[model samples]
Target: MYCFTDPWYLPVDLKLIKSIFQKDFSYFNDHGMYCHPKDNISMNLFNLVNEDWKNLRAKLTPLFSSSKLKSMFQIFVDKAEVLEEVIGSYSSRNEPLNIEDVASRFTIDVITSCGFGIETNALKNSNKEFMKCGVETFNPRLLKFVLMEVVPSGILANLGFKANGAHTNNLFNNLISEVIQYRETNKVFRNDFLQLLLELKQNQEMTDDQIIAQCFGFFAAGFETTSITVMFAMLELALNQEIQNKLRDKIEEVLEKYDGNVCYDAVMEMNYLDKVLNETLRKYPPGPIIPRNCTKTYRVPETDVIIEKGTRVIIPIWGLHRDPEFYPDPEQFNPENFNAENKANRPDMAFIPFGEGPRMCIGLRFGLLETKLALIKLLKNFKYTLNGRTKVPIEIDPEAIFTLKIKEDVWLDVTKI
Candidate 1:
């Protein structure tokens, strides 16, 4: 497929997709997204290419390790508690809850506290500065998005254009600068992502700009993806009452083993919860398309097709996820699709909601944990049903460029169980 003058290839075969993503990764390692050299914020891990990406990925991988995520579990729990209170207020009045909005607030609070080491309290106060920044960052502007994609970063930089707006960049810069200075000066250290970046800085492994960029990346990546996942999962559960009740029962059953606490170990024990989330991801993958740039000329295996250097490749994840060949009754919301027996029947690469290979999202564990914790809190305490305001057969927002989002608000009538 060619979009304008750019040649793009959409590989539908699982083996070829695997080769592109994993076996022959060196041939297509970059996302080919625009990143202006002058835009320091754009130089974060998600945008950095080749060697820079390798170095930054190596430095940041450990920060999301299981042990590190476990240490940060309490932050998720605290924010979820606040979420419960907020949702409780709506449920008490029998009001239709705009769940997407609430979910976004919950994730904003969790990400800011864990990633930036600041308590924005977005869950309680919707007008928090961090909340505003998050909304602005993701609210897609068609012109800016198209410009960033088609125009070369250098040309855009020469034209004095930034990928992100000046306001967003400045807010993150000033906030990060103040936090770093205060922490270093006062010898205040906390067990958070920012603290880990500071340690890297102390060891000369990362620069201050690198630290800020990575933190901004953390917020940008973690905030919306996880929140939308929660929103969609809740919407699906609301639509399917039996599955919702079964999942809630399983959640309660698992918590009893650990004296009714949503601890790291307890969350880990909820296998059914994992299946539900996996199915949710399959139906509504946050990142529906995987884009790659051919870094080296390569030949298709057992074929004469030659992939030229600088060509773009697109993996249609949404198509693959919903393909009836891989998943029977593809549109049905069935957690059984992720059951061990069912999973064994499909290709490993067929269900990549968080992507696959080395370039897979680094915040996979962090995002999953926060989402699961929120579900556990919400499901165990309340029951939800699709409100009349929520249109059936939800429509995807055409303006959403990066992540999967619906045009209508996901409104649900909540009831205290």
Candidate 2:
């Protein structure tokens, strides 16, 4: 069923997805995600294709090397500690906490420091410039996203149709350009993402727009996805007490190995914790849909139903993750599904929270490790359970663009362990 179709906008099955991503990839290389080299030069990686994307990916890959992420442990720990303090205040008062709000702010701080080499302290100061810009760009209203996703560029351009809410976009681009200028002028060096992007702009003739585009891409891809994953992980922990305790035990056991400190190695060592995170993403993936449009005419093999040029194709990652064939008792949250032995046996493309192919999320390591550290700190200091203030069944905001978020809030009660 077509997603934009009237009534129910469900997803297509996996067979169709494999053809698009794998077997017939040549025909579907261009995702046609919103792009404007003139107006939205900051919209880079998501739209660029062929040589442009390939060259940039090559230059950017080494910066995100695992060793680079390992060097970022201090940033993760510092931000996670801030989050813990905020949660500590709530736990002390026996207050019912809307944890997602806290998690969103925590991720904002993490993304800010990592993405721009700036510490936002968003939890303490709600109006941080970087955090405000990030929210504005990513979680646009549903109708807006749909128009951008479905409506042709010709229509938008002819009608002078601009997406609502450019305040953040303008603010962020200005901040990034200023930061880049400051860094270049002073010869300032940092191991964070901004430093790497600066290296690109200097070494590669990547225009200011390209530089800003990469920064915006990281901000869009990093913050919301990590926050959603963190909230879902917490929700599962609150609902499934035994699993929560087990995960906590794994986190504690690993941290004990590293002198009660959460580091990259300690996080990686928590295999069970990894499985839990994977399972959480499987059930409540932040990016539920990956939409791509055919850049040129293509043929669907075996069937004579050739998809004409410029047809819109939607890949329902959410449906595939929930498919009963791939995961028996799909609704049950079982970490064992991602266990080493089981994961080895699963199909290559079966798990795609981050999507597949050459265009997989560039900031995945930073995003995942940040979330892991936050969860470790929270689980170590506090134990949480669902509070009565929480909506009984989570209701997704049909308005928000990417995240599978609730219109109300996800509330939880916590006690100091």
Candidate 3:
């Protein structure tokens, strides 16, 4: 077991993360993301490192650029409004709602609109198959897949370990493959993530397996993390009414400046909204720990200790974000931590939600815009408060593989402001 199980797995502060990512990147260039190149369906950008990663990244980068995301903002706005309407209807019934489920559908709608270029109406139909597929794929047991990534197969025998999960494997493979075929045959040109992959399939010599793998990557990367982020953001907003009021004030101010429309440019102008989102991400990073592998033997700069080839390097982002040195009173939800003055005083790597370097998350712009647009519409339409049923200091769902989620139902009451 290469994983550091001896400790409680805490104390991964930002400075240590900077050493692994920026200060000592040459020693830890590759993330030990899951890959089974032989399986074809198992390959994606997340699993690729070095030149292969470089090539795929180049291809996908233009797709998520600022202009591209701006072009797609309408999709986010439409889906977010749908989410607003859906949640509003529920509030009219005076029913305590599980925002976990609502947030899942909201993200799924965004994914379908921006990823597949198809409307999922997940906010409209909670039982959509796409949402179900996402639930299965991100199941906490998927960590077993990650185990195969960092540890050698021989070591597995000693641990009684197997990497694959049947449910997630089957669900992702089928869902992605079907989406690709449907797009290709229909000659759809909506210019979303899947459509881009389809164009590659037609224009490039990339195999069906590669196409499907990229689609799978889109699904995995796009859906769960953003959904969980919205969930946490809403949860925080519900608990902190003063913060919510401040955020709502900012949203209304921005919209009023743009002629009562929450346009792409208006979302861009939301400085405080951006701060709240950044603070939420800081307190509850989607993937709190980042894992990398030492591709070659290297010695620590200050110490004589030599890290062998294939050494597993873990950067605890969550621990670092909460470190008192970088972010004083890290436990408190303070948007001021991200204000221009305080932000300029902080270290470069203290805030790494989307990561840094050439391998940074490609979908970051799109992800943030989608999240912001949702919050804008949601807060503008309704005021949220933590319902009595919701547990304080909510427990993180143990079953989520790549993101933090509420294990139990998180209910919030909404009243139109």
The deviation in Å at residue 40 for candidate 3 is 3.0
What are the lDDT figures for the candidates, one per model? Answer: 0.89, 0.77, 0.76
User: Model 3, residue 35: displacement in angstroms?
Assistant: 1.0
Pick by TM-score: 1 or 3, better one: 1
Candidate 1 lDDT, tens digit per residue, 1-417? Answer: 997787898899999999998999999889887775688888888888999999889999999999999889899999999999999999888798998889989998899899979888878878467666666667649888778768778889888786767777888999999999999999998989999999999999988888989988999889989989999999999999999999999999999999997888899999999999999999999988988889999999999999999998998999999999999899999999989899999987899887778898999999999999999988989999999988989999878877888998989999998
RMSD over all Cα atoms, model 2: 2.7
The better candidate by TM-score, 1 or 2, is: 1
In Å, residue 15's CA in model 1 sits off its true spot by: 0.2
Q: Write down the RMSD of candidate 1 (Cα, Å).
A: 1.2
Clashes of 3: 3
Arrange candidates by lDDT, descending: 1, 2, 3
- Candidate 3 residue runs with Cα over 4 Å from true position: 1-16, 23-26, 142-179, 182-186, 397-401
Candidate 3 C-alpha lDDT tens digits along 1-417 = 344442111215455556667777766778766555554544688877777877888888877878777778778888888888997898899887788788888887787677766666778877567765675556636456556644765565455432334454565567667777776688667867776777777787466678767766777788888888888899989888899999999888888989998888888899999999999999999988777778878776566767777667666778778989999899899999999899999987888888877667778887898889878878897988889998888887776655676678889998876
TM-scores of the candidates are 0.98, 0.91, 0.89
